[model samples]
Target: MEKEIKVSIACMTYNHESYIAETIESFLMQETDFNYEILIHDDASTDRTQEIIRQYEQKYPDIIKPIYQVENQFSQNIIVEYINHRRAKGKYIAFCEGDDYWTHPEKLQKQVEYMEAHPETSMCIHAAKRVEAKTKRKIADIRPFKESKVMTVEEVIEGGGDFFATNSMIYSREKLAIWPEFYFNGVVGDYPMVIFGALQGEFYYMDEDMSSYRVNSEGSWTQREFSTIAKKKKHYAEVARTLDEIDEYTDYRYSQAIQNAKKGHQFYLLLIQGKFKEIRQEEFLDLYNKMGIRYKLTSRMKHYFPGISRLLIGIKLNLIR
Candidate 1:
């Protein structure tokens, strides 16, 4: 007889051969009272990713269920999430992508215990370390670092996509099933997903850090999209459109916050392309006025003295390194 699954881990991968092994091992290490399953959706990886996946699937046929795609569904604009959602059988859903891995053996067990006790929590999450894959150096912590144990939806939204790391979240499947159409429409993945999950109720947070978020790694969306100047411009523009649609769908509840995020991207686009004059335009009026004195000075230099603006901005960017 099949053990009734308590959680379905939603993981997606494409050409992550270098990192998939560690990801699979981490999932296999999860310890819990109720049975849990890892659902891996592989989108036509040209590397040895499928070979490694098959080996694990063969050994743990009941736990590691994977879908091997012939062609890339993401390229075709298919939300791979909806596909996994249909296949997931658990009462709860957790996430750990192919490139990221959990660090604790009891990660799942602790979260399951908490959710079973708290009837009102929509999700469970913990602090995560953002590790630069190449350098193996820990960068700045993923912020909106909460002093409170329970995170309200408003608090999560105020974090501006910095609150919950995808690899660190476990959500109630019942709440997820009732998600609105806007969740499916956003091109930005985790931002909208986290927002929708937070809407279900308060989220339970564990101060224990249990996972690593690999940033700017090869085959990561961050690295691939920012590989060229054109891609960064196009990517930010697409994000603006996607988030704008979500802002409309949410009835302006989070309108100002989302608009501010979009404004930051627009400024980055202008700054990178050397379009300094537009930084002073009316579209950015509200965001510009809200900035600190330093940023306000930068904008003034961008408009009045473009040459000085580039050098100063370049120096600031270097200092950030």
Candidate 2:
């Protein structure tokens, strides 16, 4: 008979041949009292990603269950989470994308134990490290609290999508099974999913860094969408629309926080388009006021001294990149 699965890890991948092995290795390194399974969906990778997965599947047939798609599902607008949710049998489902990896071996074990004991947490998230993909240099730490604490729905709404890394998230499969229509409607999955999950119960946060979130990794949404100004504008507009819908769906209970998050993207939208005057409008005044002196100065320079600012910005971007 098959062992009782306590957790199911949902990993989505596309053309991550170079990184998928490490991702799978991290999952296999987990030490847990209960059985767990890894569910990987490869979206028709042209690379050797599927070959590597096949090797692992043969070695650990029961634990590594993968869906090798003939065509790309994400391009067709299919949410991989919903597909994996139907196949997941464990009580809880955890997320870790192909390009990201868990840093702690006990990550799953510790989270499962905590959730089992508390019984009130709708989701479990831990601190994660954000690293530069090419150089593997540490950029910043992604942590909301100085130490671990249970977070509220209001906090999650105010925190937005980047509050926690996707790899550090785990939630009850039952709660995820009934995700609202708004969850599906969002341009991005993680933010809305967390908002709805927050509605279910309080979020339990573990302060330790247990995962690594790769920034600008190959085939990542960030690299694709933010590669061009047009794409970034389109992405932010969709996000703003989704937030508006979310506000309405929640009956405007979190309207202030939702608006704050929405206006932030609008600020970026105007800033990137060189519409500095528009950013000071009533809709974005609060967000504008919150900007640091450096940003304010940079905007002024970019607006009034476009030629000089463009040269300076080019040098700055080159240094960072």
Candidate 3:
């Protein structure tokens, strides 16, 4: 009989023919003793992405199972993630998008070992390399947590809880089955998923930088999200809506943190759309009052003279560029 799969590698892709090879090779490169399977969900890419996936599926028929959609399911309001995730037949579910790849061959080995050793951890993530897709420039290395270890909810809350890298998380299948309705409908993917996992138990962290996260790639979500100012505004509002759902789901246990995060999103919306008049609104006061003295003063300055504040912010952003 075939060995039972211990982890299901959940991968989703669309129009990533150039990078999908690396992604599949990375999965095939993993040196894990325990059985794992790759579930590649392709949502009707017009490019050669699906063809490439088919090639790999044939090469590793035992380890690679693919879901090919002729009609793009995302456009049909089908929850691609939920449906694909339900297909997972493993104790752990790990995610890696088609455009991203694992760097270390031992990544799955290390992550699985840690998860097996610690039953209470709802999920775990590690550092990942953020690379600019066009220039292939090494932009920054990120490890949201300070060090490698189990993290408390308070720690996660205080840190804005946007810590988990999308592909880096490996979560227990048991705890993940407790997902709420908001996760299926109202939420905008990863943020709420991480927050939900945090609610169940502590999330482990690994300091190792073992994955590559492509930024601003063609046809990628990041590229589309920042392609225009309107999209940025929409993205921010979507984040707020997701957090609102989480707020209800958690019964306001992380209310303060949720509020702070929403304010940050709203602030970004103003920046992207030049809605400076919104500064005088009462919505920001709660965040303003709780902010540090310097931030409070900054908020006051921005509120009183939004034009000047906008000019100054523009200058600062341009300087950074």
Which regions of candidate 2 fall more than 4 Å away from where they truly are?
273-286, 293-321
RMSD of 1: 4.7
Show pairs that collide, candidate 2: none
Per-prediction TM-score: 0.81, 0.89, 0.83
Which window of 10 residues has the lowest lDDT sum in candidate 2? Answer: 260-269
**Model 1 pairs in collision:** none
Ranking 1 against 2 by lDDT, winner: 2
- Cα lDDT tens digits, model 1, 196-290, are 77777768778878888988876886776567888877777777776777777778888877866777777767755656567658986655566
* Residue-by-residue lDDT tens digits, candidate 3, 1-321: 878999999999988988899899998999989999999999899999999999999889999999999999877877777766899998999989888888999998999898888888888889988887755556788777567987766556445434556889889889888678777774357777777788887788899999988887766767655588777677667767777777787788878878777777676556444454575468765544555777656766776778999999889757766
What is the lDDT for 274 in model 2? 76
Deviation from native of the Cα of residue 290 in model 1, angstroms: 10
For residue 95, give model 2's deviation from the true position in Å. 0.2
List the lowest-lDDT window of 10 residues for candidate 3: 154-163
* Candidate 2 TM-score, C-alpha based: 0.89
Lowest lDDT 10-residue stretch of candidate 1: 139-148
lDDT of 3 at 80: 77
Candidates 2 and 3 compared by TM-score, better number: 2
